[model samples]
Target: MSITSRITGSKHTFDSVREVLAKANEEKSGDQLAGIAADSEAERIAAKDALGSLSLETLRESPVVPYEDDEVTRVIQDGVDEAAYDRLKDWTVSELREFLVDEQTREPEIARIRPGLTSEMVAAVAKLMSNMDLIQAASKMQVTARCNNTIGAEGTLSFRLQPNDPSDDVENIRHSIREGLSYGVGDAVIGINPVEDNAERTKRLLDVTKEFIETWDVPTQNCVLSHLTTQMEAVRQGGSADLLFQSLAGTEAGNEGFGIDVDLLDEAYEFGKEHCTASGPNIMYFETGQGSELSSDAHAGVDQVTLEARCYGLAKRYDPFLVNTVVGFIGPEYLYDGRQVIRAGLEDVFMGKLTGIPMGIDACYTNHIQADQNDIENLAVLLTAAGSNYFITVPMGDDTMLNYQSNSYHDASALWDIFDMGPAPEFETWLESMELMEDGRLTAHAGDPTRFLEGDR
Candidate 1:
């Protein structure tokens, strides 16, 4: 079908956009975007008068060697690559600064994609996109989430710690607190998902949130806590979406079990705004396979509906800069649908495109496993295309042999190095470009001993 016809077809309720366009035409139109200007080249030599006379002052000591040569210094100074050195030699300081500081030089930009196919799911995607954009716009800070629960006989786990102290594991709690505040993130979402009932879980979550705020003004570093897995009061928790809506729209509080209450969330937002000095810590729901694999259809159902709406609403409310998602808890089973994940990921990208939001993929798993390079690369490409520039997971090194399950937490730095999209320069090569004096001192001149593009300059 033709584009115009498709837009007006059964998928869309619009009978005609011609009238809308006509009305828009009748109204005033603002200034159009300016066209790119063409440049003219003129290599005209300046008259000697225009150039003015110039005198060069030689340094008191133009030592062949800029500094004292020591073994350590020599080692530090000998790592520059030929190509990089050549580039440096050709560049002036201001030019080099401009090159390094320019935004265009640092990161890959995914072009903006317009929102299409408005639906609950699309809206959610749009919101996530919006939220992600907001996050990227903010200063980068370390953010972490932690949870703990005491499983009850009803299959519903009572969230033990308040939002503030979910982890009884002192080490985990300390880690979460330190991680969040150390970088001044100051904001985080704490939630619980029940394995059984929603209402009970939510009650517990609220109780914990309240207790957390009252307990420690600041938490210890490296503490362990129970993370939330489910919230029963939500509509999709064995009931209709309507029930969830009613709950969100309902009373302020009664008692909770797991998950979040809309009223409580609002209260927390206010609390954070007033007391925490931070603006907002969002609410994110974590779900795992209820002993069932993630079918393409189920994936569609959530990505298309619940997740979409929830994120969109949050974006509209908080207008977060970037939207980050943990693609179902890290598990081997879901990896089966890697292809499906790719598809769903694409949908997320398109949705973000429409909303001008950037998204980040969070590979949340307890196992300290390194993901496959091909999978990581593909996901990175897909995410970048979808307007994401950040990832939330452990750093990784390029060890093709190191699978996610086999690695240990001690390798986090390596993992971080591998998984991160940021530019990483090798240490040894950085030392070679220095314009070294016989005495071995540092200098900024590209060929000087001090000029290391990649490292210990």
Candidate 2:
């Protein structure tokens, strides 16, 4: 009379679904016996005995389902449209591999599903692809193999100088630069964001940076990480800067807060070409990371990593001098923990390098996340092995102003020693000329360069 009785064909209440399933199994076992009765009793008894046995030979002889193959097909089919699914449903493994490589065919369209597709799905498809297909896709995506040698010649170390207080006077800021330069850092560029975010203060900071470069002849560039418009305003007011810096995102809306768009970025690029006096190959420095798309509510159902790659696509259009993935700087809400941070950092570097941009990693983490210096070091070593162009080196590995820890000067030194890398060619020349480097190693002056103070005497 009740729903349970109707389903079970008995007036019994199930305490849980497990009890109902157990009853159903009992009935199924009886049905199986009845079906087996069609065979001889001796045969049925032998079959039962074989199934009941735990013999190694019998277990080894049992049929094993190829669950991994089934799972890969399920994942691929799940993300594809029905029509696309139908087309691929009958494809052989060889056919699938060919489809991924056939440039003249529309097969790549099958891979262009909606953005919410999981990494597993992407990886599954990737697994089916050959190295040639992967390389072609990377090339088509405009992934770069190496960084531009304009700012830091290839294999050079670089660091950013936040200076704890952007409002610090020229002398105080000079002190920070002196310390970083003494350790053979910042050969790439000394990038700083103004605390005041005004044209006057921006110009003053640039002036101080220019003074330091001229005084030391460090053969490096400087960056002002304010809105492009602010930097342009400073330039119009007779200010100077080597690179124009901004934080960019994948989506239009995500970049709107910074008043940036592809068009605006183009305009800024042209403006920098006109105003920037640096002899570097490019003048634009853009920073990006995951979670910004979701943070701006502009993700549009796209996965964070894919959207982040889209940002790189946009960046490469301008032929940027430096592109940095500030992994873990935003916090755990997007990345969640150190494992996620490490993965994202490696992915960014791989994607960026494949996109053919001069890619770097701001291998860093916030306190709120399950990350520490060791985590950052792990990423740094991995990224270095992956051909990362540069990283952000701060004092004692802690950025007082940004409230995060990144690769330290010591870490950079270790990487140099371990990898036998040095500063960019131009910076290396200056270091050698200044006696900061001798025979491809840091001179004692690199640690205690009192030459900067000799003018006082």
Decoy 1 TM-score against native: 0.34
Candidate 2 lDDT over residue span 65-180, tens digit each:
12143322222223334553344444332343354456754413533422222222222233333333544432233222212234333454454544445354667666667777
lDDT of 1 by residue, 164-267 (tens): 33223334333433332222111122222222334444444344333443243322111111222222232123221100111110011111322344345445
Which whole-number lDDT from 0 to 100 does residue 104 have in model 1? Answer: 57
Best of the candidates, TM-score = 2
RMSD of each: 24.6, 15.7
Q: Estimate the TM-score for candidate 2.
A: 0.69
> Which parts of model 1 are misplaced by more than 4 Å?
1-168, 171-258, 279-310, 328-336, 349-353, 356-358, 364-377, 384-386, 395-457
lDDT of 1 at 8: 19
Give the worst 10-residue stretch by lDDT in candidate 2.
Answer: 58-67
